[model samples]
Target: MRGLMSAGLLAMAFTLSGCGAQPESHEAHEAPEHGAAAEDYERGPHRGRMLRDGNFAIEVTIFEDGAEPEFRLYAYRDDKPIAPADVRIALELKRLGGEVDRFAFRPEGDVLRGNGIVREPHSFDVTVTASEGGRRHRWSYASYEGRTTIAAAAAAAGGVRSERAGPATIDERIDMSGRIEITPEGKAEVRAWYPGRVLAMRAQLGDRVAKGQALARVESSHSLQSYTIPAPIGGIIVEKNANVGAMTGDRPLFVVADPAMLHAEFFVYPRDAERIRVGQAVALRSLSGAARLQASVEAILPTADLASQTLLAHVHLPASAAEQFRPGMGVEGSFVVAVQPVPLAVRTRAIQRFRDFEVVYAKSGNSYEVRMLDIGRRTPEWTEILGGLKPGTEYVTDGAFLIRADIEKSGASHDH
Candidate 1:
């Protein structure tokens, strides 16, 4: 491109046949020898003294093949390069044009732009300097390009190319990852517990039924006469509170849907619940169908159920698997209790229960050694070991029960 531009300029100067001789005008001079503009201009072609000149405003733009834009100056009649470091910059953008951002030059190759660098390209001006003896020449250019602002700035500095910055990152580590659902779980509606006519159902079943959706109509039965029953949960009603004139029973009249926001609920031990989160990734498996599912905890119910003696965990299913799941299904899963990946872990089945101890039959030196181990956070395929293990230790995962059966048979043979 530089050669092409230089050649074009020389050709145009050759065409001007009748032009009069002037010191600064093209008269009796040969085309500046290759690299003469840069190598000779600084030397005044002889005394080797750098002389300062007027601040000529120049606009620059850059085009990059694989990275951010680079800068080049096309500002002065005698084109000089502009650079980023030469001018002070301030951008009114969240990312673009910041000290560490990327941007595209506005409207030309001498412009700049990039992803981490631009909101939108705007016109900008800058002041630059070139070494001339003991003084400097300075100037500025407006940018409208989108990705390489720095490139343009550099171009305006010296009309020379600058190197590309390091590769940009994809930034895949999400600070948080979780699932969301339109519904929740185990919702009991505060509907009438006893037989009663609708005194007046004030809160409709689907009216975002609160913990207590009440009916206003008075009743004839003593139970009904005693008190009005409010709906227990806040949910869209799946059933009506009616049969207006019929003898209503104690059974739930308003089949208030306890929306099952979670695909499955697990009981997390108190010690485990303390480490669990509302949005931690979990791997769930259906005990019946052997389907593997990935999901997030929708919630950790506020308090443990006294009778059940367990903490309620609501798991929101992956959108991909929701179609095949329903409420009240049995599932087994591991909730990531920690963020950091631990070492020396294997599938939970790699170990077997030996009376009251956790033991793994490890193969070493041509013998099986029953190894006692400490357990940690467990995923469906891996269980982190807090003790008694190391990476690359050969241990059996599946067929453990079969191994035990074989050992028992051998003992019977010995007895025989």
Candidate 2:
């Protein structure tokens, strides 16, 4: 497939190089060496191509002020204006992919107007024929814009790659901020069963302990018997407030939290509270974006924060994420509220601003041209194409800016 495309591109380049005026012929003939230089031809007062054949001349122009582009031609003889009805004209445009557009003209006011509108990207090889006074005149030229050709090798080296435009699933998400915390059921506070003196302290802050494991030895003040203080849960000791000879009262002596069981608490303001619900999927990343994972909302606390008046949405994390995530670490989350399937879409990164339109470059062999788009729903990853691009069309997906730069370097004109 690639070899065939390369051969086609080479053939297109060869054909484009032979662009010039040719006499009328019934049989296919080899195009003469390009000698017209018509692309740089003189412009008439209407800013249209001025083609002369001895004493007869005609100016070709595309007028598109308040309407679609349509052909408007002016005729002349002996360098003087001539009646439009006295001359007959026809135009044929051969586009890049061998598509041909034929236009017939009729007198409209002082100029001859074409029957059809000229579509965008305005790049083609044109053949024009005019008849008057028993004589025939023909002209041909190449008028191209917003297009560039790069060799496959150069394109690959420049990171240019293409993909077929097609349907995609877009995930609509709402962003929120949150912090990782230990769930209530995953934390335990250790306090002496009876008023006692701390006879011995075994566990230290940040120590990992097993459930019911001995953490300390305390002597009861009422019975003078020393009792073992065991850990209430299997987790890391986050807080320790006991020491040898320290008297224990109602205060907790140690706080153990199960880091393996963690949840992220995202704040939901009034504007978004109605949209949040348990079981919705969420993508979470650390504030620095160095760690990321997928989880689902496990619960929504009924009460809102006293200061911020924001509700809490909790998403439980897997034990595997504990290595990268820690309690109180700030995280950013994207909650998927909806998923939509679009008939045609492109990667959001592929879309670029060209003139006043958001566009993506469509690929034909090695030739790349602008495709003005009508965009609809968009996410960070994909954008729905409402119009202006055909399904299954190959388009620049990577290195689109490189193609744009090459076209801009040629200074392609929007002239009619």
Candidate 3:
């Protein structure tokens, strides 16, 4: 009677317990009927989507937890786990770049296991097939938009930086060898007006003389009157043929060069002559790499060198480079062939190959997102951003590969 009384009390408590229990949520009740409710799509046991076929459902996930990523599947029938040996599975992935891969699974202990690892970044259209009891079921889905995160400290240590994208000036250049020469307007040759004897010499070789400064005094043989020969330009005397009492005929007494304004003569091949134009910026460098100058194309000689078939382009050097240059110095010039302005640009180091697409690491505070870019024109140091990036936004400029390596190591490669 005591045992009967206690059993009756337990039954009465159980009946009262039902009155206080919480009812099942609407989502849980609808998942089976609608084949994995929207909220539970990525909330399954494997953190993957569940594909339903008739009464059986398969949850697919790429298991990359601290190891190489691989496809793992869970099978269920009528809300009960199905035995692995009862089903055969195969997975096929078609990538965006027209690449296709297939994986087959076999029974391994309690679950169906893939024969090999799944390629990263797990972004593709997936087709999964399962055969059970001599009947086959198929399901399809797409995943992996290419995303990842990194610690702020790690990113800074890896040399990652970002900036708002902005416009940049791009100059297309044509490289060619050239030589320094004296500008025609900057050279002067002082000569006697008539046949005479040089009575006195005021200037010598290597002497700085100003325009209208007397270089030599000469006594004409006809008039017997002395006349002074003045330097036509302000420069150092590079040539002095006059001596005291030396007879002057048609020869010049002195040659003066004003090197502050000089010319870089570019010997362009006939094939490149048509593209050469005046007023374009040119960068000149000595063969020894010790000297550099900025100049502009001033003229293009019409005649081509008969032997070399090369045309001459004269570039005017700035006064700043005058002291470092000398006539006949061998140099190289990069002439601007074209100039373009890009509204958005970034350092070339920011770009990296992530799977089938060219990508950049976009940073947002402590996290980094993989941004696929549509690229356009490219220069040596910068690349034009046509898409995938916005102006005034910051991104990784250096050490981007560090982020990529970390993400890929985390099974985010997503490339099949």
Highest lDDT model number? 2
lDDT per residue for candidate 3 within 1-416, as digits (tens), equals 00111221221100001000111211212101111123434345656567777778787767677987787788888857889888888888774444588898877776677778765434455678888888788766544334334455544544557775678877788899988888899898899998989899999899998898888888999999999888888999999877898899677888899878688888999888888999988888899889986788999999988999999999988777777888889998888898899898888778898777888876656545566788888765578888866686667787677666555544432322
Choose 1 or 2, whichever is better by lDDT.
2
lDDT of 3 at 103: 92
- For every model shown, the clashing-pair count is 73, 0, 11
Q: Give stretches of model 3 more than 4 Å off.
A: 1-161, 166-169, 288-294, 341-343, 348-363, 366-376, 385-393, 396-416
Judged by whole-model lDDT over C-alpha atoms, candidate 2 comes out at 0.81
- Residues 1-416 of candidate 2 have per-residue lDDT tens digits of 11213322332121122123333222333333322334545778798877788888888888899998888999999979899999999999987667799999999889999999887757677888989999998877667666666667667766778999999999889999999998898899999989989998889999999999999899999999999989989999999887889999777899999998899999999889989989999999998889999999999999998998999999989998899899999999999988889899999999987777899998888777788899999987899999888899889999898667655544556675
lDDT of each: 0.42, 0.81, 0.70
Model 2 RMSD vs true structure = 5.5
Model 2 spans > 4 angstroms off: 1-39, 306-308
Who is ahead in TM-score, 1 or 3? 3
Per-residue lDDT value at 328 in model 1: 53
Task: Quote the positional error of residue 345 for candidate 3 in Å.
Answer: 2.9
